[model samples]
Target chain A: MKDLALLEDNAPKPGLWTQIAHPGLFLGWSRHLIVPLAVITAALAAWGLYLSFWGSPPDYQMGDTVRIMYVHVPAAWLSQFCYAVMFASAIGTLVWRHPMADVSQKAAAPLGAAFTLLALFTGSLWGRPTWGTFWEWDGRMTSTLVLLFIYLGIIALWRAFDDQLKAARFVSVVTLVGAINIPVIKFSVDWWQTLHQPASVIRLDGPTIAPEILIPLLVMTAAFSMLFLTLHLVRMRTEVIKRRIRSLELAAARAAAGGAL
Target chain B: MRAFLAIVARDLRLGLRQGGDILTLVLFFVIVGTVLPFAIGPDRPQLARLAPAIVWVAALLAQLLSNERLFGSDFEDGSLAILRHAPLPLEMVVGAKMLAHWVLTALPIIAATPVLALMLGMEGETLLRAIGSLVLGTPALVAFGTVGAAVTVGLKRGGLVAPVLVLPLSLPVLIFGTGAMAPMVPGASGQALLLLAALGLVSVALVPFAAAMALRFAGE
Candidate 1:
């Protein structure tokens, strides 16, 4: 009775960090999220796609090529958005030392890279007809490409270390360094734009875009956001299982070694 | 103070002990410069126009050659482990190492850049501005590279990883560095110079802590 009471007394109340970061608890809740989230993402995506392709009118200046904006804008937004999540997760890993945060950071990299590449791809598609060139060395395009490279570098860093725990620390530093770097590069490239283009160049989408196009774009972005959330939660759950499997494998290997000894 | 100086001195002494290494970096820098003309065609005006950018890229690549070893030797010998526990903070040690790296690697390249630029047909103020940009920008390069070095120091195949990681971060420096080479307006390059210096100073100021954090956890 005394020992049980002592155990109860000693147990620390979970804080916000712990509540959010507990991998087992995360797996439980995230499992529930996966289905509903995927369903919503699909519905939103269909609606968004329908509105983008059929519902909205062709752009005045860009014609039908403007439809590519629906996919391109969201991918571009998610590219930065995913990095922001990774950056926060990195801070969480460093400060909180939580496996969930590490899982998020590890999971977000490839997704971020995919989004960045998509941004580059869809952007080039849009660029071809609009600019009469498949590639333009403008600040936005160049910076996005650089952002893609940064994402790849982070992914590479994650794979470089044999020990995942140690990798987390190194990755956190790199992520933070990258976060600091992104703005500086953005500024510098935009500044370069001033040098190369003394005259203002074409805007991808002019400010105050008509609501007909803007609503669908926003809906598609929300769909992308939902898709990213569903994927992120699912990835985090898989990472939890992967870690468990890794530990079990390590333990079995140790047991075998012990038996031989 | 003494401890900080000691790291810088130790690294400097060790770097100097390997004489071919410095020569190799300078050679690499020049070779990159020489190869560009062949690939891009040796139109004098075109070469002159591209000279500043060529120098900046070569300088960055040269810095990368030394980055893989920035902390590897010490980490291998376990001195890095001890240093983490030492009286001086790891940030100070990283800062010292960064300074030493800058001194050994970047300085020689900076010294040789004017010659490379001159050979590429950049003359007078353009050559001077290119060199000036190097003076301001290379520290930012080293500062960011130190973080890359510190991040990858634990990896077995860190060489390629450091460049991949460092190059994107170096984009701003490349832009502003080349910007300072030819001021569009008379005072324009000055603004580029100021931004480059800010990048260098800001990076130099903050990178130590980040490197130190990475070193600490990676060591554990």
Candidate 2:
């Protein structure tokens, strides 16, 4: 009747590490994925580097440094997009208590945090060459900072509990409810005269980018999405292993007591 | 409904008996207000610009300070179990607790803001907005804090944990509560008010059931 005790008793059979550690087997389920993702990412980075130096056109407005958009834009886009995934997963967990929803929530936090950092880093990089300063209290940046804080909050809340299940549930609920910030960030530019430009790529009508630019941007977006997937699979595997190890340790202690008896 | 009122009144009496609790919150508010002006320096214009936010933040911290005891006393004394078993729906019980919380904690914070306003040299239209916003806003804070307190109430060290868990959820209130008073600031105070009201309505409708469920889980 005690769920935690039952979970400990049913801990994954030993050697889960050996099971997943094989490079070929590990890469099998992900081979089609690993090869294509790597190829595309490298190609895009190459294309981006090429464009940064040679092939790509300059921003009529922003000039050569606008090239940072290749990285910055996708990072910002994915950061917000990852939050949307986290929020959805949070809702799923809170409303239905789906088991996988916890995995999804746990997986999404660090990804979102990484994306946020990428956006800020590339943003600062782009800003230095373009805006003559690296940081500003513009609404977009402020909300991005808020997004980072929310991510940190999620991680902190998750770590605050001694009981993992309780911590997961608590953080899950908070993430879903706190998602009100996503829309707020998107509309911040429109609502306030933010220094960040209004939406140019995703719009009600359609994307306004020239095909030449749009293609690379879309490719990069795909590459980043795949990167998140690959990282997610690895992280979730690690979490599952970690949980199994914890249960095994607990079971060992319990078994030693039974033997003593 | 009458039973609910009785519960509310009973809670109010308990709150009154523990008068020092509310007094401590007001004292925290006063001390926080006093320290902020000195910390930020004596420039009047800067104070005027910062006063609304500072007051709201201090109020939030004080509310959080008081939130630890919100359900802990009753939950520990087995009173919460009695309330849960009572004929009233958990939502009603939650509502009553939220009302008691507002009466004890938020009401004083709302009242204290005007005094803080005076101390910080706030004048005219902004002062009125500060009072108006807090009056409209703090109920939602109390309601939201009730849910948060309920969620974490069963955990050890939950008091410290609750604020970090709740603050992000409380941002809309903070953003708007301060926005309502700081007129030149770009946030839509009216929209923020609407959101705060909606938050109160939703929390009132849902939180007691949620709290009840969380309590069950925690107790188990």
Candidate 3:
């Protein structure tokens, strides 16, 4: 303990941000965050569920089925939100070489993918009732599907590489390159929908949704965001630990080889 | 500029040395187009209607087929690292390689497009526009494909994996390329061509840096 303490004292001091980003310090600091965030997520989910199903009144046109918006909207929002997080983390990995940044990126891809898939699945279920078809090759749906594939492809890239550090640089380049699609997806509706033909079939853009419906949608989005944060933090922790185990195993193998020599 | 030209010339010579590889891509592209009409039933008007979409899809796939080949040999032979440390920047090296790739693979495919177009019963103005769209759009495909190639250079079985990473990003190019081929908007040379040009310009401008970065790390 004295040797450990002295070693800690001998280490050079880093800035607050740099210290926080250190994987060792991240492990120490992020532990306190998990439980609180998890509890908050649970609370918000419960309240949001109640508001979505029970508190909000039925829509006059579509009736109770309109409640699907509470879940669908948030999942769609998270799909984009998670990509944005990964893109930022990728920048962190490349520009600053922050060790935690790649871990954050790796942790986020599948989560973003899950949310994108959820958005697609729920959107289809809602579509059957609303658009009278389970699938449409419209701009918004097509872009989201492409986004899902991008996430899956990134995961495949991760699996293909043996060295995680080497993978980070390449993945960061791909992630940054893929970022251009985000704005294209965001404005897809506006670009393809109007001027010649109005959105008579799909009335998705409710710029003036009622307060009761709006409140639940916002609450559910917040809950979903918290859920994502909780999952991301836990996943990052596992990845950091997994990498630690990898290095330790390598070291052990080297020692055994040296002993034979 | 001389160094960049030399790099381009080297890649071109290397590609021409194995010239059958270029023929294979053109043949692969033609067969992909040929097979489509067989599946969809070769109704002349229908084939004409679908020709643009077919050509673009085939072009995208043809570009994808050569992605791993772009850097696989160079990295394995340690030439990539040599190129990296060359006086010209890695980005310029990448751009030169991309130009060579476009010449060796895509240019042959485009030259062979007329044969596929003739087979599909397409003619005249639309055929010209189709080739125009390919000229404008393929640089973007080459950029993305080169980056995909660079990204996968470190992987043992990267050839199979390059398409998985590249195809999703190729969506916009496909959309605009197909649109540009058809006379979608009749007025004033069409909007799709302009959009295709923008996508091409932006992708060419920005994507080389990414490819260069991937190559840099691959060397490390």
Encode model 1's per-residue lDDT on A113-224: one tens digit a residue: 9999999999999989878888998789899999999999999988888888778888999999999889988999888888877756588655978899899999999999
Query: How far does residue A54 in candidate 1 sit from its true spot (Å)?
Result: 1.8
Better of 2 and 3 by TM-score: 3
On a 0 to 1 DockQ scale, where is model 1?
0.84
- Which candidate leads in DockQ? 1
Show model 3 residue runs off by greater than 4 Å.
A1-11, A185-200
TM-score for each model: 0.95, 0.83, 0.95
By TM-score, how accurate is candidate 1?
A: 0.95
lDDT value, residue A27 of candidate 2: 36
Task: Give the per-residue Cα lDDT of candidate 2 at B13.
Answer: 95
C-alpha lDDT of residue A190 in model 1:
89
Give the Cα lDDT of each candidate: 0.88, 0.71, 0.85
Worst 10 residues of 2 chain B by lDDT: B182-191
On residues B1-220, what C-alpha lDDT tens digit does candidate 1 reach at each position? 9999999999999899997899999999999989988999979999998888898888988887878888889988999998877789999999999999999999999999878988899988888888889989999999988999888887787878889999899889988998898656566699999999999999999999999988887676
Please compute DockQ, using alpha carbons, for every candidate against the native two-chain complex: 0.84, 0.34, 0.58
Pairs in steric clash, model 1: none
Sort by DockQ, top down from the best? 1, 3, 2
